[model samples]
Target: MSVQLRHYFRLLSSTTMKSCRSNKLLANNFIIDFNGFYRNMSTVAEVVRPTDPNLPVEIMDVEEYRRMNGIECFGNSVADPIKTFDTYRWHPNLYRRIKEIGYQTTTPIQAQSLPIVFDKRDIVGIASSGSGKTLSFVLPALMRCMTSKQDLWPRCLILTPSRELTHQIEKVIKSFRFVRSICLYGGVSYEVQEMLLNKANPHIVISTPSRLETIFQKGITKLDNVDYVVVDEADLMLKSGQQSSFAHIMNNLPKKRQTLMFSATWPPSVQKLAEQYLDNYIRVNVSQTQSLSSLTVNKNIEQIVKVVKESEKEDKLLEVMNELVPSVTGFIKTIIFVRSKRTANRLVKFLKKESFPARAFHSSKHQEERDYIIREFRKGVIPILVATDVASRGLDFINVKFVINYDFPSQMEDYIHRIGRTGRYKETGKALTFFTAKNIYHKSNLIELLKETKQTIDKNLIDLTEESEDNIIKDDNNNNNDKDSGYESSGEGNDLDNDEDESSSSEWTSDDESTNKTKKL
Candidate 1:
């Protein structure tokens, strides 16, 4: 057999034979038969056509492509724009898989980052959640395996922060059916994972950093042959305190391999991690603003904050839930986030008692239970999900119209991630945060974020800040001395009036009145 044909046969045989030791001779004989069959058919005419018949024939203009696709290319000598998957020159099987998945147009992140990744260059893609970041890396990894004519041994390693996300990525990879991939995470029997690794000999391994590190340390898996490493939601991984594991995993991998780091926000910690590992990596920012804080939350979301007494939280949440359900369109899919597992459980119990279909998701839950909850949530079987920060990072819950922060996050980064549960995939959604005086530390940051998003902020919430309090005292003193100051003597009347006007102008007029108005008058 020729060198190329021999290598192709070896790869095909390895993929077909799950057990390397027992089926070695069988795989060799099968490959030999396949090679003979291929040689017999080599005389036939080769047919080449576009992967998708509906694909445009001509290359789209660079400027027009950028505008149409919302692409922003940033790198040293970035490649030409890839308007569609067909233009990327992927293997025919991979192209067919893409078409089968019903993806005609590339998302902004996919359009810009795919070229750099396909070029085997490291990249840091800063795009919002549900912006198709998974496929941006998955496709390139699959294509890398497809073009190669060698037996695969976990050439691509994708590390995510959560098991939910790891499973999601594995699901997408499996959909292609061109490569073998396995999901590795905690809360499962290590022996099972080891068995699968030895038997499947997957081309790609999707896993959490800690679990993958454990598997590496146990000698069940090795990164010696890995050519591509992808860290999805890198910020979340670092925040979840997996930085050391991430570093250890990278340290063990071959230094010459391609690395792709993607996150909704590139905080300083994530940046430091990237600099330590990624060499001359291209940075792709899909957000309108270059600032990481502004890019953290999706601008498509409408953020609403309510400052209430601690005792009123439950009642307020019940009010919100009641309003969200029993509507003409049916109940809205919602995810309520809290800071701790205890809170999540308590909230779920209360919600259930209130006749809402609710479930609590946290690290304490078994992997199977969490997986089931996620699936049900995605299928819209459970409209209300109360979860901790564990659910914030990478799990894509489709059609989540509302995200409620029952407990304000300790950091602005967490707040951004919590709100990101909604407004995904460019869909307009609402994020309602229940703020209390106990969460004073996050008050200023929350106000700044609201202002940045151009959302109307409740003065009560903003005025609770020390700086705003000082301003309030100054205005009160001026009003007390001068009757014509316009600030009412009580001050509450003017503030209440302003709040009414703001709420009326911001929410009621724009949404409710426009949609429900009987007449223009």
Candidate 2:
């Protein structure tokens, strides 16, 4: 046999063994039987498509993940089980809440992880974003807290990478009503979080890595009696800025606690951290065979790309908006993802100037404004939100029709979460991304992810690439596609324009000139 064929055969054999190993891990880690789900893994992995062609989108069995090693996923892996109350079978209150939320079925991550957590077992869940892994731990953690005596300040501590996700987890925990929870993050005042830490004596504490370090340093509360600890978005926590802060928090946690580490993607660093932090833990995977539609939203999204000259990007953004706004008003809400907070603010300001009702959400906004924007967006009063990657993971906004990557994501994993914001609740949606010649080199991972999803590249968006030149930009073609391509030309060597498509007035443009919009930054 040829070398390529031999490699393929070896890969297949390894996958079969890995599948068996993963099953054993789940059995050993969670005490659940999922052999029924894995019986047809060969057929399931063979069929890879972007969208699920049926109702109540079928969840992939979480057991099919055994094949993945390193950064590559050989087959579409199922997420860990996101166990519901029925999956627990012993928890009635959780069951009632599940019914109340209208969640009749358990997603794969929820199925695999929930039962293990409910059983008070330590676990490391390696599912992708939008895999319902939050609820997997939340349900069980809250259940454990509810059953335990409530005098402790926080019996369960959940750590996430970003401040936004801390708030999201707090919201989900509060929905339980049975569990009183508090969110602690750096951007918000430490005084307020400390106040809640004292008065609420919360059952759960949702916090970002830095804030947790501060709490430990300040001697705010003892971690001596903590029973459950969760590191949500753990992979991102391992990123440069957060690694030290997380290590400090890990050192402070009680040694005899049930530790859980959850992240969208499990990289080598995260795996190493798990070995150090998690004990006899189970690992679970639930990335879709394809796209975000398998999770909450963006499943029906027909992602299209628009490549434009760096000088003309702003104009193209507005043009895309002009064509999309009317339809978005009727069908679903929209979110535009920008690379920086300044850009987010600029885009929002530009849209408002054009009489489009839009809001900018990022770490820069005041706490009150941030809350207002999220509340307004959730209530459907505001249809469009311009945001940074801060909104990417763990924040669920239902009925979002389109997710536009005004800037391509920095990480391949982040692109998945960014687009995941739309096409929720079994509805169809669309994703549009603008790739300029300037950013193509910086965004190669994003390009690879797009190709994996089987997304199509519009000719208008394909900037030509030199074989050796990773950073490439295509020459602009002044094609007469539309009547109003009023893009501006910034004279910088890069030829990048901040705002050309949307008409700008002196009154609307802010005096501060920065790339990102977030005021706090």
Candidate 3:
């Protein structure tokens, strides 16, 4: 071994022997020992760790590779050519809005999707999260509406799977300043949604399927003038949530209207929805390696997974959280997703009792509560949010760096949405998930997805020991996990720390007995 390598081994030995940082011992039994530290100090070049003989090894010291190649941040100005709004030939009002929002250049998805929509062509855009996919459709929709004859009801309709996503899309659309748009979803007053829809007579409207279904049933005239239709998170719609609402809306839409579907992953359901609504649509996929590829993040955070017993999951999560707090000193923001609302609420309660500023979201949170929590989360008042499939789908919050999967989804696609909440908007984020023995069946499908994305799981993290193979069984099961049995194949973190005592933590108190049964917004 080189002298430098010998010195590093000595450092490792002292650290390990002192019992600092690492809670568990190294997997290999051999402890680093300094054999020749003084004489050959200048000769040491590289240090390598002993491999776990049983598991397959993947050597990916990306930082070292980058350094060796003299690659200093390739994604800076040199890699991406910037484009101004004037280059797109946008309307003056829309151009002003885009500039105001600091949108100097069009992202690849936006660049490709904008023109097709502007030309009145039906489109299917497949892009990774945070690729400015929303703006791609929103800009064209608003510009077209603002320039055209203003319809009393909305001329354009955007449908998102969750209330959070509906609100997010609406927020982006509303930035047009000159354009009028309304966001409709459950948990808020029907009168509120109705009044906004009626009084604003918005040129564009974004909503969830549930609320839109109600609007249509209540003789809302807005449905008739909606010449442009957008189905966001069509995969989520097809997977676990209600498809009837979308079907009803499609049945009611004017046959001549243009349609657009955008999603990170297009499973069979999205394809079916596209066939039902989109006509001769042009497809635009911007993900570098398709669905399973994770977007790049700043190298500060490291992602790893732990395989545990299903029954011990809660205990393991608690242990990991305690271990993470001190290691990551700052008040780091985190997002955690559980498979069911019951489990989500339970976890939130546990965190609250542990004195963590955490909240749970699902179909169960009332409109006002959901609204308050999401706003608080965005404002950083609530540092951590525990959620069900609703938060998993398409909610965008870029500052989130740490995400944890308390319960692995029965379907692998949901796993993608969960991790996607972090590592967004060109920022670095870390994700740690707990995969239990029960989830062993999903190993193959998940591995296939990773392979498709030209990526591989960290062998150190995934324990692929089970030999028995069984496919994930599909069921009619939706949100309640009580709705139907089997697997609703459709849709859809790290830690540091050691300051607070676990048993004495404070808990969040709620007085509202009325539950938000199917609240989406």
Q: Supply candidate 2's per-residue lDDT for 354.
A: 76
Query: On residues 253-344, what C-alpha lDDT tens digit does candidate 1 reach at each position?
Result: 99789999988877888878878899888887775443334355578999999976556779999999998755576578898887765566
Q: Is candidate 1 or candidate 3 better by TM-score?
A: 1
Question: 1 or 2, which is superior by TM-score?
Answer: 1
Backbone clash pairs for candidate 1 read none
Ranked candidates, highest TM-score first: 1, 2, 3
Please give the CA lDDT of all the candidate structures.
0.70, 0.61, 0.61
437 in model 2: Cα distance from truth in Å? 2.0
The regions of model 2 sitting more than 4 angstroms off are 1-84, 149-153, 187-191, 288-300, 328-332, 442-448, 459-463, 466-521
Candidate 3 per-residue lDDT over residues 1-521, each given as its tens digit: 64544555566557564564433223222222222111111211222222222322122233443344222221111111112333344566776666677886556666456646665778877766666778878877877787786545578899877667877887887666777888777656677767776688788888877778887798764477778888887877655455887888889888989898887776666766777677777766554343333221122233455765555667887887777632355446788777655566667778778877777766644555666888888888888888766777667786887888877765656676677787777676777877644456666555555565445475733555432113322352332233121122112211111111011112222522234333322
**C-alpha TM-scores of all predictions:** 0.77, 0.71, 0.70
Question: Any idea what lDDT model 1 has?
Answer: 0.70
Best by lDDT: 1
TM match of model 3 to true structure: 0.70
lDDT of 3: 0.61
